[model samples]
Target: MEFHSQQPIHPTIRKCIQHLDVIKADDKTKQIVYMYMESLLRERDLIAASKQEPIESQIHN
Candidate 1:
């Protein structure tokens, strides 16, 4: 997807893209980096979802 001026891309994501471009020949390293990024995204998503829940309900659970 094209990142235009209207859509702000995260700085870390941009850096990862640039890093992957330079290591295209190393599949193992690329896989490790990709997984690390995926885990971070998942953690961020979980945090965001938790914030949307009511504090009372979260405490009850």
Candidate 2:
């Protein structure tokens, strides 16, 4: 849970936290934002993985 000084947080994550704080978001709203963020992160990961795969493999499937 504790992040040491050596490990820096991601900018997107930091921005999300700051936005949530500024809005004084409620629990329900916070949950919605969290879910949206999760989806975005998952999609980004999938895109990155696809890019790493060979073009032939991508074309076949």
Candidate 3:
């Protein structure tokens, strides 16, 4: 997904994704980085949610 100027991710997250000063990332590289970042964010959210839910609820069927 092409991330627009404004989206669900925070400005810092977007900026970090957009501005990686390494060997100079082209469009494809940027997209790859963004995808990786998105996945990381998704995982982070899942972990946070798991933590937020009660341990009993998490263990229950």
Candidate 4:
């Protein structure tokens, strides 16, 4: 699963992710942090997407 493409993240969050390398942690740990941030982005995107206007067409397709 590609995490970065999941959704648009806030600038502050992106900055934090970039700083992950500054932390004294292994690759696996850094990945875990990224995944957590990615999840937050997904949640944010989901909500934003839901707030957008829906299709006017009645067709399910």
Global lDDT for candidate 4? 0.68
Q: What tens-digit string does per-residue lDDT give for candidate 2 at 2-54?
A: 22456465578657766877888776776676667767888999999989998
List candidate 3 stretches off by more than 4 Å: 1-6, 20-24
Q: Estimate each model's TM-score.
A: 0.60, 0.64, 0.65, 0.55
Q: Residues 1-61, candidate 3, lDDT per residue (tens digit)?
A: 3567565876666786657644566767777777887888889999999899977887857
Which candidate model has the greater lDDT, 2 or 3? 3
Point out where model 2 deviates above 4 Å.
1-11
lDDT of 1: 0.69
- lDDT (C-alpha, whole model) for all candidates: 0.69, 0.70, 0.74, 0.68
Q: Best lDDT goes to which candidate? A: 3
Give per-residue CA lDDT, model 1, range 1-61, as digits (tens).
Answer: 2335564546776687567777663656655665677679879999999899987887853
Summed backbone clashes in each candidate are: 0, 0, 0, 0
Which stretches of model 1 miss by more than 4 angstroms?
A: 1-18, 23-25
Higher lDDT: candidate 2 or 4?
2
Q: Which model is ahead, 1 or 2, in terms of TM-score?
A: 2
Flag clash pairs in model 4. none
Task: Rank the models by TM-score, top first.
Answer: 3, 2, 1, 4
The sequence of per-residue lDDT tens digits that candidate 4 reaches over residues 1-61 is: 1235655766776676667656756667767877787788789888888677476543375
Model 4: worst 10 consecutive residues (lDDT sum): 1-10
Task: Assess candidate 4 and give its TM-score to the true structure.
Answer: 0.55
